[model samples]
Target chain A: MTTTTATHRGFWYRHPNLRLAGLLSAPMAWLVVVYLGSLAALFITAFWQVDDFTGQIVRTFTLENFQLVFTTPAYLTTVARTLGIALLVTLLCLVIALPLSFFMARVASRRWQPLLIAMVLTPLWASYLVKVYAWRAMLQPESGVLAWLIGPLGLESPGYGFIGIVITLTYLWLPYMILPVYAGFTRLPGSMLDASSDLGAKGWRTFRSVIVPMIFPSVVAGSIFTFSLSLGDYITAQIVGGKLQMLGNVVQQTYVSNLPFAAAVSTIPVVIVLLYLAAVRRSGALENL
Target chain B: MSISRPTKLILTFLALLAFAFIYIPLIVILINSFSTNKSLTWPPSGFTTEWWGRAVDSEGVRDALLTSVIVASAATAVALILGILVSLVIARYRFFGRESISLLIVLPISLPGIVTGIALNNVFTSYLGGLTFLTLVVAHATFCIVVVYNNALARLRRLGGNVEEASADLGAGGWTTFRLVTFPLMKSAIIAGGLLAFGLSFDEIIVTTFTAGPGITTLPIWIYQNLFRPNQAPIVNVVAAALILVSIIPIYVAQRFSSDTNKGGGIL
Candidate 1:
């Protein structure tokens, strides 16, 4: 039998906001405990010195970890290489995604639009490791399809190291980049583009003035994904790059090697990404994206 | 000279070419799953079902797939429950620190997976204890909860308070109203949210890698180790193809549902 809900029965109900606040408390606690607190804990560990034998950290804090991160050639090069890869990946995503997304937004038939969108997002659901492994197989020296296909073009060993890894990363992250761009383009006022053409502006000029401003936020969002994914990828570089250590690999190694110094190196990118997000939010790009 | 039909034709071809660029590699992987190559040879020398058989029989692969399923499902269910509760509170009431709370939830996802892995690993080892599948589920659910929360919260905000007021005025009880009105309306969003969460959790490797420790190896870990093995190439392809199949279903369903609602001037 249905019972009428007692209105304002409990002390907590005296203030509805307090009751609502209580309901929100669980998720907030999780955010604090897991997201914010873990980072704080990791940051503190970066300052602690590691014991030689036991592989335990000493309570005594020092700036030596930070110093080692700066001085070490391996750590520094890995950081540089990771940044380079991130930049390249972002550029590649932008180049390919911009036109494709624009076409999807502007040209596709209404019935086909959802299908196209689904096609773009399908890859995001695939098992990440399996996707990477698929690439590794596809990039194999003698047998990979690339080796066979590009043979006529005179490029020997099509899928060996850096190029192979870069190609794979581009393929995997392309969807992420395209989604935001598509969203941006879809939200644009179509009448403005019509007016631009009506005013006798050429296609390219109209695109520059009308399209770019609207889609800029999408580029930022897509760039964030491509850059951060590339920056944080150790497995892709390790597996596909054939044991090549990127910044992500360095972090893994440092954690595995029990090197407090290397651990400190990993902390740098976290700060960089967080700061980047903060800046984007401040710039009002978050809402646009 | 100003505008040519040939140029328009070329642009259309180029657009189709872009789709080919996106789809061809994946199609190759799918096609190769049925190839008879001992290694990953191109344009297969022959055809066979042997790899699919091998994929089924391999203990390591079998165990890994099982582990992956368990982890993904558990993470999804937990995150969905939490997402509904949190979204309800956020949508219905104004609270202090709401923006900051939302940011905290969203921030973990913005940072790359590796950083999250390291941070979670640091916490588990230093503050908690020996890592297990449970811990991996927890780590995965953290980010996944945010996604589900976003989807459900957006839906909840649109629903508003009229339904509850109507139910109460009609003499329906709190539990009855929630079950009949609020819960039924939330069903589709929750399904969408759950599907999204499942895809994410199933594919999640970075977070799982950190928390899995020594004992647990999921399908990703299994595939990772055997990626370059010449003998296992066919089996790997079969497994990879299977993974692709598994991942695409949920995304396709969700996208179709979401798009349908949008066309209907937003879902209730």
Candidate 2:
């Protein structure tokens, strides 16, 4: 009885295309049309002008929004500041992640590596708002723990400003950096390190020659997360950035009143990331996704 | 392969420092939840359970928690179905755009989430009526699919086609082979992926902020609102400390399912 049903269904399944289509239809409809189409639709909206008086989108086509994004010094500064912060965060994460991930991947006892990785991952489950707010409390100029800890040392908390935003964001995204770099380090063969040092190379020399090149792609892979995440983050800036604003804050502020203009500013980060992704595609970093 | 003693010592010291940096804020949160001082003063003026008691009785916290659970569950369910379907297609069949599909799957996560949020917001507000609970689910499911796809795809690539072929040779139909054979093999990956998807959706704020309706409040959204208010800050800490505690089991279970062999694989 089952044999008969199997043979019957086998006739339709003989064609791989039909089977593929059957599997692909739902996901495709959801992803291609709903996800990609929405993105395309958004960019289309960016080409139109918003009516200033009515605060509504005007359907007529214009490049004025993009022009304003390019021409306006305030928007340009936001772009630079955002780009600067993203780069700094990525650099700091690399510096911190390399040493820690190296320890976990190579030096830690095999029995404990998984446990450490799990420990690293647990913080991710904590609420994002809570982490940012915790930082806000910690950097609270007068009453923050940071101030209390450092005041006797004749220093102050960076105190709810650009530096605070940097510290908070780096903390928030640290695990993302560590995970990939650790994975990269684990992939390294121990013999390669031995090979370099055996041939008269010192620690720093072998590290520069053997390790950095191998892990560069992974660093880029981690950067994709930290960079893009920082670019889009307005919440951290809102909480600890004092009066500082990023492109994200600008977009959020103008989203309702000037959708077209906000969309244009958003294109800056999107284009920059797309370009970065394209540059790193050769390294096969996208495959790491 | 081994470093000098000094280098090893330095690495270990830095590792400890990194762990401390990761954990201190969390400890502060745990402490602040019990702080008697409402203003979040340094060293905590006093310790009490009053905030935790208030949080337990708070109607808004309960309602927001329920909403977050519902949304995350729906998003996870959607992501699992779509992830499996997509993974099966790519893993089993050689289609025209096979390589590009992986890129497509990753696009949601690779793009800055704000871009994704506003893009979806654009579509929802422009054509699909105002943002609602469904829109939020859709936005979350988009990124959640990547975690599920990665887990399932890696497993499928490992499993290859032999078992499925053996089942087919024995006269098992596509549906029968899947139900009896492939599904069991893929179960762990799916569970790990689903937990990951659920976790992502549960804590997500940027995308949720854009797609959620005016009255809809997920826990993160609730935290964002309350953390900014002076009086509500302690209550928010209670909720956060509680969140960290409650979240451990799902993460532990997920770690068990996927195991350690995968090597630094992130679910999201």
Candidate 3:
């Protein structure tokens, strides 16, 4: 009986395509049908308009939503602000992550690497809302932590606005930047640095030419997280943004009353991310991610 | 790699500053959780555990906690099965559109969360009846699949096919080889992935906000709702402090089981 069962199973296993199909079908169905299908539905909805009087989504294809998103000054400014914030956050994360990751990967002793990495990663596990809330507490203009710490220096907290949002976002996404860049640093060949120094290249020259070029993909990988996350974040803005708005804030606000317009606003980020991904694909950053 | 003394000192200082930056807010949450002040004023006026006790006894907290746990567990389970299946195919078989499959797996996560949230929200409300617990699960599992898939794929690739070939060379059938060999080897990876998926699901807020039906409040949603309520603010701090404290365990465990020196576990 065992031999017969083994023969039957072996026969099925001999056909790799059958085995592949068996393995691939369920996950593919979920991904293509549910995930991709939803995204397509969303983009399709962008070309739709909501009837003003009836407040129903008109199924007819129209460029009105896209036009409103592009043409309205308020909407256009929101898009530009969101893009600026994402870029600033990504740049801040890079600046902060480069040194921190360098310290962890190169300056720190090997025995301490895992512990240091763990320390950086611990904050990531903290609830996102909680972290943003914490930032709220920290940024409370007059009596907040920032004011308490920096008041003696004649500097005040930026006080829950554009600067505050950027700071909080940079802090939030810094770990995402650090880990990949740290990995890149670890993968960097020590010999290359040694050769560069031996060839009389100064520290800045070696860093700019050799280190930057090699770790560029990892930096881009980290930037993807910072950029997209900042672009899509409404909660942070809501909690600490005061009167400031981003693309996500608009989407969240309009999603209920004007989903078509919301969908159109959302496409801006989607298009930006896709274009960013396509541009960075040449750097092989997607694989790094 | 070759650094001057000044550069090394500067890097070290910057790294410590970064660490401080990362941790100060969490520490603030911890401190404020015990503060007698309701507004969370700096220096905290005085320390007390009354909020902790209140949080422990809060019915809303309990219900939200239970809901989050259930949703996370279900999502993790679904993600585990899908992750294993997809990773097995990608790792073991050379097929057409293999690269595309990997990209497809990543798409749900790589895009901004708001896009994903609204997209799924549109579908759930329009075509799928309405948002429900099941909708939350599906939405979460979609993104959670990538975490598990990456871990499983890494482990499967490292495992190679030689062991399975050896098992087949013996009298073992395909199912037997998988049950007795492949599954066992992949167990740690699956656990690490599941832990990660659970974490992702548990902490998810943006997508959860869209997909969760009325009356279904996950922990993060609970925190968000309560964060602004003056009377509940201190309790919110207590919960946030508790989350930061409790999160260390799974992260540490995942790091240990992740086994890859280069990747530093599921965090990536």
Candidate 4:
């Protein structure tokens, strides 16, 4: 350490830029070459196509991989289905998290707030596979617990398909939704609510007019997690999706047999998230996250 | 805010309902770990400690547990070094492309894990030799670094350069200033960050699935495999119950550091 420090005293001790360069080199090299480079290579690989007749993959740059992704009904439908599920999950999470978050952020006593947040967050640590599997048990038909519980209501388990996927995803990601919304709600000034009410706005009106507008960015921030996560997740869908395949499933399935197509398929989510990030950047929700 | 009794009651009811909804699955998982029913029908037909014993004794569970700990520790160690370096660069420097560097660092996380997983898989298969335990560690460390980076960056931002300058002015060298002054102040934040990173990597399945070789199995992989198998399903609950219990300490530590908005992403 002393020898290294003495050497550092030679040049690094004098030049701040050299010091910065020295400090940044390892991490930058690791992240840029390892992570960003991989992504760039993968995205570029998406453009390479295989010769169907020759049964050979060639790295000729072509739009055919993306063309197939954009044009094929199966690919298009999968994208839509994935996006649809993502949107639905985001919406459902909002519905569940809004009131729950409001309760934590505003309605619940300050003493209970941290506990509530912790309760919401603890599920995250409980292994994603386990939570999805637990839902798998509940969503099982016939002898499933959900069946037993909802049997009296004459509604069976959603039975591990699209609805099952959404429910399980909503369950998995509810905390992601709750926390951002809770933070947003926590950030909302109490005086704003009072001002709204004092201005003769009713509770619903105050919420609609004041709270909703103010909290919308946080909602957007939360939705980014729910939507993007559900979009990319194939595991939950694998456990409980039962014959239903999403875009993630498409990519995973195709990756082994058709790497180029899979890479192309992966780009759809990346593009969607980039666009979503761009949209939410205006909402100022990115910083809130 | 104006509150009505009925509204308060309704909000309270919703909060109670939300808590129940969040907790019921966890409660069921815990109960089923004790339940004698191997097939896992709820209401927990009967209670038994036998599964817990079996789970503890199970070689597969033990091995997978060890594998998860090893992978998480290696990943966290890498994350600790790289995160500190990245944070130091971003916090202390006012150089060209600084913001871009930060964005580059965060992209691994913000991009879908699948993108990251498959991209790394692509590179590993193409150039780095096919997926292995090392690949798994690299993949996990890539994402885990973000937590540590955020926490340390937040700490650096909060602490500023004054203390380091004071040490330097007193004739302490850069290394000395760091070892004696900066490191102690950054220790708790790094611990908080490392804990979050460990937790993230421990539970991670997406990236691990892509990077793990045919022979490797982390705990989540183990859980996924046994989740639905008729005989082993019950034991999964035991493992999960234990994981959840053990994971709390890290989550709590993370929340304690949540005054830093960067760590406010919290358990996610």
Worst 10 residues of 3 chain A by lDDT: A1-10
Q: What are the lDDT figures for the candidates, one per model?
A: 0.75, 0.87, 0.90, 0.85
Global fold similarity of model 4 (TM-score): 0.95
lDDT at residue B172 of model 4 (Cα atoms): 84
Q: Encode model 1's per-residue lDDT on A140-191: one tens digit a residue.
A: 7876777777777987665657776787788778877888787787888888
| DockQ-better candidate, 3 vs 4 | 3
lDDT of 2 at B79: 97
Listed per prediction, chain B TM-scores read: 0.88, 0.95, 0.96, 0.93
> Candidate 2 on B1-268: residue-level lDDT in tens?
8789999999999999999988888888888889998877888878999899999999999999999999999999999999999999888887689988878898887777788899999999989889999999999999999889878877788889999999989977888899999999988888988998898899889999999988999999998888779888878889988987877877888778865325344436
Q: Where is model 4 chain A poorest over a 10-residue stretch in terms of lDDT?
A: A1-10
Off by over 4 Å in 3: B261-267
User: What is model 1's interface RMSD?
Assistant: 3.8
Query: What level of docking quality does candidate 4 show?
Result: medium
lDDT per residue (tens digit) for residues B10-33 in model 1: 556766877877777678888898
- Report each candidate's C-alpha RMSD, comma-separated, in the order given: 3.1, 1.5, 1.3, 2.2
lDDT of 3 at A79: 88
Q: Which CAPRI tier for candidate 2?
A: medium
Encode model 3's per-residue lDDT on A149-177: one tens digit a residue. Answer: 99999999889999999999998888889
Residues A109-190 of candidate 4 have per-residue lDDT tens digits of 8897667777777786677877887787788887777888889999877888999999999998888888888888888998
Mind giving the per-residue lDDT tens digits that candidate 2 earns over A1-289? 7677756697768876788888999999999999999899889888998877987789989999999988989888999999999999998998899999999998889999878988888887777877898898789998998998889999988898889999999988888888888988998999999999899999999999999999888888898898988888899999999999999999899888888888888888999988888888899766554
Q: In model 1, where do residues sit more than 4 Å from their true spots?
A: A1-13, B1-10, B168-177, B256-268
Kindly give the number of clashing pairs for every candidate. Answer: 0, 0, 0, 0
**How should the candidates be ordered by TM-score, best one leading?**
3, 2, 4, 1
